[model samples]
Target: MNDPIVKVEKLSHRYSVQWAIRDIDFEITKNGIYGLLGSNGAGKSTTMNIMCGVLKQTAGNVFIRGINIRDNPVEAKRHIGFLPQKPPLHVDLTVEEYLRYCARLRHIPKQEIEKAITDVMGRCAITHFRKRLIRNLSGGYQQRVGIAQAIIHNPEFVVLDEPTNGLDPNQILEIRKLVKEIAEERTIILSTHILSEVQATCDHIRMIEQGRVVFAGTVDEFDNYIIPNTLIVTMISMPPADELRSIPGIAGVEELGGPKYRLKFTDGQDVKERIIETSVARGWRLTEIFAEKSSLDAIFAELSKK
Candidate 1:
């Protein structure tokens, strides 16, 4: 069987006396986009930095492919590409010049440098802007250049830290599309506090909270991590609060005004089915009934508590 592309075991880091991350562990075995999701100051950057070999961890190991980063950083780093939150852009150089320099830094063979630069530029859609000064490009195009540099060496794993942090909405969408395109042949670890960004771009998730990995799984699993307790029900004929509360699994009922009501239920109960059957039998004239989606913040809060 093929080995994992990345493995992080007991990964922890500390700044002064404060722990930035603690005992975080996970693995990436396939080619796909993985999200490192968390709030600001939730250790996302600290963890990414360690994984990319930018910062040595206070404790534990980060393995790229099969090499331990701490024991063979130079070799491990060759398989990794990193774009930090603040891009390491040399604004004075034109896009092609910067890419050439990056390719050399990645130690591409002298004869193969031009093709490497050309290929990465084409992949990142920055081919047309190759001769333009990076500082002169729009934020979206600059981001593309950033991505180009990260993958210039054709590394198998890439780490992008907040790749669309300050871009406008359209730019964000463009970058997301570009990222998805880039991930087709390589594993990408994208760190972001934006929930929608993860939902839009990542196939898997590793959610961190308060210096620890609170959850790690597929994107759909993360979305359903916290079982929804509240449901929105709209009816033509409203029932008394007492009657709605009496339904099995319903712990509470709230009148949301108009024809709408909020029903709260326990985690394991088939409250919706019961509500539908009860509404039909009693002729409450049910119009709509659906579970309330827990907000990103609420999910984060719940995971943190756990």
Candidate 2:
């Protein structure tokens, strides 16, 4: 098996008095998008900053391809590209100039700087805006520039914090597409509070709360954790809740809204077929029967309440 591209162990960070995060641990084993999911102040920024070598963790270690970030900061950083929550843009410089500066700063050989800038701009779909000043670009275009800078050097790992924080829906979609395209060869780690974004973009997810990882798994697995065994029902004609409750192992029939109900079951059994049989036997008018999967919003709410 290929060694992990990124490994973090017993990672913790503290502010002046309180801990920002505590004993966080996880690994990125391949080239795919990994989401550091959490709410505001959940230590996602702290963790990302540490991984990018922008900040020092109070304790523990971060390794990029077997190199410890703390012990060998420069060498470890060579394999990383970072886009912080607020982009660091030189507003006076045109898109091409800023990217050229970034390529130079990243130590792209002088001979290849122009080609690197053109390639990155093309890859990020910003070639047309190359002559536009950073401050004159739209939010979406500016974001593209930020992403261009991050990938100009073609680092092995790209760390992005809230890459789509304030964009409109179209802008959000565009950036998400850009991130996915760029992840083909780079292991990308993205931090965001947007649950739908994680569901839409990431192959695997690590949900954090209060600076510790609360859940870690594939997107489908995380859905299973929240959903377990459930079903959604919309009926035009129906039996009394107690009558449906007569079915074996059903915990409760929850009224959702209008004519819809959310059925909770015991032992995580998927009894949609049995429920269908029962409904047909009763000659009930069932307009729709959907397998219930809890929304990420619901899970996040539950986590926040804890």
Model 2, span 128-229: residue lDDT tens: 988988999999999999989998988999999899989999999999999999999889989989899998999888888898999888888877676556
lDDT of 2 at 111: 95
Misplaced by over 4 Å in model 2 are 234-237, 254-261, 267-274, 285-288, 304-306
C-alpha RMSD between model 2 and the true structure: 2.4
lDDT of each: 0.91, 0.88
Error in Å for residue 143 of model 1: 1.0
True-vs-predicted CA distance for residue 217, candidate 2, Å: 1.1
- lDDT string for model 1 (1-306, tens) is 376899999999999999999999999999999999888889999999999898999999998988999999999999999998888899999999999999989999999999999998888888998899999999889888889989999899999999999999999999999999989999999999888899999999998999998899998888888778899999999899999989988888889999999889984467788899999999999999888888867777788773
Clashes of each: 0, 0
In model 1, which residue pairs have backbone atoms overlapping below 3 Å?
A: none
Q: Candidate 2 has what TM-score?
A: 0.91
Worst 10-residue lDDT window, candidate 1: 297-306
lDDT of 1 at 31: 92
